[model samples]
Target: MRVEDGFQPVPFQEDNPYTSDPVLPSLLKRTLPSSAFQEINPDLERLGADVVTTIRPLGSSSRVYPPRLTQYDQWGRRVDDLETSEGWRDLKAYGQKEGLPGIFYERKYNEHSRSYGFAKMLLMVGDVHVVFCPLSMTDGTARVIELMGSAEMKEKILPRLISRDPDVAFTSGQWMTERPGGSDVSQTETVATPTGVNNAFGPQYTLNGFKWFSSATDSHVSVALARTGSPKAGSRGLSLFLVPLRLPLLRSPSDPVPPATSNNIFVHRLKNKIGTQIVPTAELSLEGSEAYLIGNLNEGVKSISPVLNITRVWSAVGSVGGLRRCLAIATAYAKVRSINGGTRLLQDSPLHVSQLAAINVLYRALTHLTFGAVRLLGKSECGVADADELRRLRMLTPIVKAFAAEKACAGMEEAMTALGGAGYMEENGFGRIIRDSLVEKIWEGTTTVLALDLARASQDPAVLNAFLSWVKNVVSSCPSDLHERLQKPLNVVNDAVSELASSLKKPIAPLVPRPALILAGYVTSSTYLLEHVIWSHTTGEDERETDVEVLRRWILEGGMVPATEDVRRATQDTDARVKADSTMIFGRSSRAKL
Candidate 1:
């Protein structure tokens, strides 16, 4: 008799998270100095194996149980500590030692630092159970401070932020949202008034406000926005301040506290989030909190751009990490799966093979797209990027961030289905995979917000030239037969770009148009895959076969629904769309029961 519960392997290999990915090695090889990345490749690859073998299983259990808020000690001291499983702390230690988060700051790695750093981050997030959350904001905060902080701020904070030393290491908070304003930072009511206080910690501003969504609430320091000028100045009027959770207490005779203590940041409550449960996100009440301004006063909105962009990339990487893990699970399950008779391997089933392959195609293309953006980030930061590369890098950010998150949601659902009922069971880990990936679509910025940002970037001439010219060059470079193979999708994509340009000519266009956003992302992602594969072929790297398979699946095989001619037609007819939208939003059905 066969046991019903004996089958553990899904369609995926259950392989090491790092080396198992067919895409990562070649990508790093191409984007980074081969010598630098290759030197570290074995180490990262082994780390990847270690993560799969050790860290992930630990995370699966630890994140499920999650950390709890211990509001007080047994003696009734208000410690406000978030107590977590040892595995959680272990992952943090791994981060410090491996330089997983700080690798982005290592100029020794040359222009490839972002590529190599994010490559490690991509693998780490897969099964580290959203440990990427704090790391993402931490890296972003470090970058922001490095770029805009006063010399003193840099001297005081940068070392700790980038330090691999456990004793000196720090993570940071991004406290941007208030209860009333989600993405609208202009509506932030947090107030910062100069205390007329100056001491060893530099200038001080007293902050009083409520922060609604403070991710990494346990962080030692944070960057926040508050109105330092007229409330009417909106986002432009706000200032960016680096608020340390615990500040150095001046031992003045007039002061009530010790030389170093809590900076008056009170944790009001922890959010019981459906996803990213492992992260200690909380609501905060700041009363007379002290902070130092990081950038120009009232340029807070602009100054925070570096943080926003970097974090969004991490969000994209994290989305792919979740999808990659799910696919790994699904692929392993399919290999040993059988009919009730136990005679036929699910791997031999044509339908099953095709299903997994379809998702793999997406995984491959998105991996290239996301990593390509990282390469551009490094180039731009290192001052090697030309005008065109800079424009592409700038625009590619929103496109990749939104696209990866959207596909991760779709991919995880398919992953769950492939694993049968066990996928829904908590112990199998698919519950967290799907649940965690769901928030990816919501975090950083919702799809609509990112799409709008993408759309705005598409209209600029430099961006347009950078994108269109590259697409044309890539498609045009294909040898005659291969070029012919790509012609239809290329034309379809170019038409979408042309339409976008035409629409932008009209002053009354919506900033957030779904069709335009979808078209831009699909076209660019497809092109990135095709171009990379072709480049590999010319250089003798041998990825062209798989690359062609992905291109045919996503572009030529009618895989992208919104990129089709029909959707394009529907979007162009503004009058009909308006009427349909009005009927849907304003006019209910005539036979409505309500």
Candidate 2:
């Protein structure tokens, strides 16, 4: 007889991600009006099916074949060319042809268009090897150009940035991080020298400096921040520039191709990163890079602010997508994997299902929080937002970005744990999921940096008052019976809000920023869930029960407030805590003398 192998486990098969997710459709249904939902639902369905069948395979191939750089040609002349895999190229083509960026620009349904476009993103991002990273910058670049670019720049570049035709489309790299500073743009050292000359594209400059981190390095152009004034002028003295990464190849009339020229952008090296490896991130020296000024001089921060807002929203949505993917994998594995010596499937185990439920609950909460911001974005972009919506959008953008990312990191880890030993195996793909999710917490702004931004936003009386009033309005609108049902969790949320309000006046307020931001996220997300539940009841939709259940779970289980002792450590007893932290981290001898 032939040698027999040990018992083999059957491979796991994942259901179509769009159909398998119970929460997303219900969310779109609850958020969009009946007519709008009917109109966009079919597109969402198509993209959902394509995500698993087409986009995912391309994503896998991209990860398998990462990007590389060629610094010199065969004859030893400097070329500085970047090469990406066909799968990466195909994914980019698919995204462009599918109108990932065009959907928002088209605004076919007016303000609902962003929601429609982002819903497709929610379904597509998880399967696409973080290609959304470049797409995010591209969308941000388009938005900035639309709002701030010179008329000529807008007419020439904006359309291509958002074009649906892959051949005509362009992706943009955002180069903000520099060696001297990470998130602190005030410390940026890149300098731009005005050429004192106007090219066809408008005023030109020569930029010289090194960009520490340049994701989407393979992109055709970049929106960068460089000092045009005294270095001591800080961020206010900086100006935004559009830098071309490559020179157009001049083509002969017959050849229809031209000789390649340099834009003076030299890639020092591709980043060896933990995740998002499929995206070509690089360190580069901008040596006399040709640039076009965007907006007025000494207003770089203001010009780039819109781009940050857009990308931050992308980060939030992408974080949720990553968590969703991990959950999909874990959930699929649970059905096929056996336990109790093969007597029962893992899905049959209540404990296992509960583990999955915990992840699901967080995923649902983050989904609402992110999409709520997306809806506001659409309204703002369409010029239909009220003053209140504008302020809400400002505060919520940073909150959702930092909070969703931090929570999703933990949720993705839990999802991995749900898969047992198989999750640790690279072939199972949890490794890439977790690694990619980790970057969300750091990209744009880390949690600490964002917490400070939230603190600043709240300090503005108009912003804080608007948020508080909105919360009150949402709470007061609840129907009586449902209000009674939610009274306890609502009180929990209110209490946290009150604490935040009180802490803002305290001398230790700076110490409270992180906790304060956390409270804000909990409050807003809880409010969104509560609002959805009310809508579910009023609409009598099929998702009412699940909505209520998800709302209750999120309010109760999502850690609505910080612990009292933790608060004390952060605020009231900061001195003692610092000493303890120093001792713990630096050893007993390093503790400060009292």
Candidate 3:
């Protein structure tokens, strides 16, 4: 059965079920180069230190904020007061000055409970929930550019935004994804009719349409995508507007600012999601809402891509951090937990050793790839968008999100196995990790969606050719002495790609398990490329050569070949293989279905 078919809560046990293996930790430690630890060690320490400070004061028995408390006490109270102009004024005044909340706010809002990790980090403040709806009315960042573009708007808004006791907070909401339109901005039905000038800030537009799933729903300003051009104009016709949730006033020292107003933007409801629950995902209705245009009329999508690209990288990093945490927790637990009456869990078993070893490789490879992608993103020229950089982000985003999340879930499950029944309990945190990690794959995009994207990217001659060339370049750059060791896996990837290309022309049936195997091999190949690049750069050529040899022999002699065979069998066979020979012929099939 698929891991997600349903939660079958098994009873917690006191003994390890994976056998009396004691070499797991040592085996894992041996496989990872000391250097891999060097790069991440400091950061992990810093994070640990930070967590100590953050969570220590809360005490050991404190629980994540309850969802009902957040809803009834926080959101409800804020909304009821928000119904008043005075309440609106207070929120705007406070938000502008405080810069909103951090992780603390998320904990208050039950976002941790809801699963909005990063978003909660962005929004949550001390004990109270801070609202972000109005501030996100405009494309918060782009609005800065637009306001700067006009000296009048700048004079009016910039000072308060920059002021020590600012009265307004600027946040942005991404509202382009529609129910029926697959990320296609042009197919949006939201309309913005030209409304008469509000005062003298040029032409004002009245937005009247539905915007589903806006991030930063509590912000005061928002940049909303509306149909300003021809309805049939596709993406080019879609224009972005700075929608103000509250009326704006000139930045005057003497004048009394009026109470904040909600305009006509109404929230339909908040989304119940697998993760990122702290940041409210709201369906909004903009009914004759006041809005001003930012940038040229037909360039909204292009303008948004830059910001989205940066956010994507941040998301990738967040996933990596979570995954790393899972690994660390699992490994640490395996090292300390005793299995039987006399022996530690990781001290004596070959199977346990093998599992931990495999996990270590996955963790290290993912870390290098994620960090490398981060570096690549950092290297791209600012302002000018590079398609190559974007493509790389696109390609890596899904892989990191999907693979890291899946591995994290698996790692937690394995860690639980090490703990016997204790790990399965809520108090142990392994169950939480598994619960939380499940959302990572579903978020950004499902694995199925990502696989399709990969398939499509492979079909684009330019993208496909470029990717293949890049892979070849990576293969060529491997240390000469380690070529023999790396050759088998590299060839496996090449053959798979060739076969995939050929299958594109035919109506190939679902390979079921084969796809997972192929995907694993591809990821392994990619990991090798990433690890080589990072290790080579961090260490000298000579050191990298040695490390490469070690990694090569470890991977080849390890379970990779058997794993591939298992994938092939699971995909092609209708019946289960019970015999050892049958299993070996197919490789190691996953006990857990996709």
Candidate 4:
């Protein structure tokens, strides 16, 4: 006889993420031509089902079996052998075969190909255990090589990076951080001396340095920054190089041991991170590692900017993906979950529904912001965009990246709480969602660091003009009746923009960088959301009511614009605020001012 164990919550059952999503298909249909939509939609639906049924289970297994590193052979030889779980390997191979990195280059739908690729990724990321981290770097590296690599380099590496054949495909690493400086690459101490040899890859150089953090340590090749000029040259002293992490894959087994094992790269240890355990990050020592110079010497910063832009976009999308997954689970659970001793379903409860509603608004807005930027990227890459579109993409990149990361972190937390005690449990999977989402804020760039970048870009007259003009154009295009319906929210965005533009003229821009960027993101996202509403009306869609309310709540309930008093305090009450803050932080023994 079994004893009763009280009531057990019904397990949540999530539908296909791609089909259950109300926004993605509509956005794609509105933006792409009918023929292009016809070509992509079916494939997206198939991928959507695969993510839930196949990819998700594999991802869970990956976390269960984390990677291991073996530093020595039985004979006492120094061999840094990194071993990953079978599930991780299978998922990676699956992603490669499905064009995780190749879709961007395939151009099957021309400019729309990026949307197809990103949409597929958006669905897959919810369950891939962050395998996308290394693949993100691979995508960025491909872009760099395609745009900047010499003929030999492009011919050799580009094919493998974009290969659909899993056995032949390659993933790349980005090794930029050093012990002396994390984000500050200007202080890089790595030295690269010319080896005076030209190989199949490119001109050879020997890199000798210690890299503090190398994400995706198991990659085949990496793009690194090393000083090739005077140490005093700051960022200008750094030059970009292509460092192969392993010997040529096609080499015969008896090819003289390839001169050095692991291409003279030694992995000190894998990082014990809070999330993304599936990704093997490492501390590395490049001892006479063979590398090929990428572009003009001492122009590493300028050359690597393109890669940063691409990865930042990936960061934004990854954040939204994580939130969407948690929200879906929470939503599914609420409908069947009962309260009041089975008298009512959780979804029927007003308070619970209200919390879910707020999170939905945030998720929708972030989706628009992230995908809007992706569309601009596609246009710019296809060489079809005019000057203003390019400028808008540049401005939107950091703003969307910073804004989405911060909001998604908060949104995921709220989503977890919606599940009650089950959310706090490790087995339910919300733990992984929250932990992985936090990295989005730190990687690519921290919220504060990206806010500074936004400040610099907003100060540029051209970039500022491009963004403001876009907001005005989008808002003014709204139907007269719809504009009247959304008049209050419209006015809110308009006023916020005016105030931000005014603030940019003063020195307060630096002091209120985060708020300024966030305000701009809200304003920009409002425009995109408004544009979607307009599209719905024009197409005679039935979901216009819910769409309109989402926009309304985003402005009125969500606090799209920061308070003027807060901005004033940041600029005006700086000395008092700083002294108090420092006193509290330092135990009243420090003298500090803002």
Clashes of each: 14, 3, 46, 0
Between candidates 1 and 2, the TM-score winner: 2
RMSD vs true structure, all candidates = 4.0, 2.5, 11.6, 2.2
- The digit string of per-residue lDDT tens for model 1 on 1-594 reads 466566554434477777778788877777667689768789778888887677776665734456788777799877677666676666775776678567778767867888777777777776777767777888888888788777776777787788777556788889999987798898889999998876444567989999999997767688899888887888888989888877552233354533122788877778999988777888888888989887788999888888899898988888887888788888888877876578888788888888888788778878888988888888887889999999998788888888889877788788778877877877667787778878878787888887777667766777877877888788778777666766776666667566655544424245325555566677778778777767776677777777666677777553455554433464466665666676777685622432
TM-score of each: 0.91, 0.95, 0.64, 0.96
Error of model 2, residue 241, in angstroms: 0.5
How does model 4 fare in lDDT?
0.85
What global local distance difference test value does model 2 have? Answer: 0.84
Kindly report which residue pairs in candidate 2 clash with one another. Answer: 250-258, 251-257, 251-258
* TM-score winner: 4
Task: For each candidate in the order shown, give its overall lDDT on alpha carbons.
Answer: 0.76, 0.84, 0.48, 0.85
Instruction: Note the residue pairs that clash in candidate 4.
Output: none
TM-score (C-alpha, index-matched) for candidate 4: 0.96
lDDT of 4 at 108: 85
Candidate 3 per-residue lDDT over residues 1-594, each given as its tens digit = 898685444333222211121222222223334554344334334433433353223312232231221223444532312222333334334444433222112223231211122222222111112133333222234333433334545555444433325433344556776665645566888888887675344357888888876765654456667887887788888777666655553434465643333476766666676543344566777778888766677777765554444444344434444444444545565665555653545636677766666655555455445554444443342223366655654555445545555554665566567656665766665554455446556544556665565555445556545544566566666666555656776666555445444443223334432354235434444555445634454455544554554455445653445545544554444344434445566655733331
lDDT by residue (tens digit), candidate 4, 261-361: 55889989899999888788999899998899998899999888878999999999999999889889889989889999988999999999999989999
Task: Give one digit per residue, the lDDT tens place, for model 2 in 412-511.
Answer: 8899888778888988878887888889989999999998888778777788888888888988999998888888788887777777666655354446
Q: Among these predicted structures, which one has the highest lDDT? A: 4
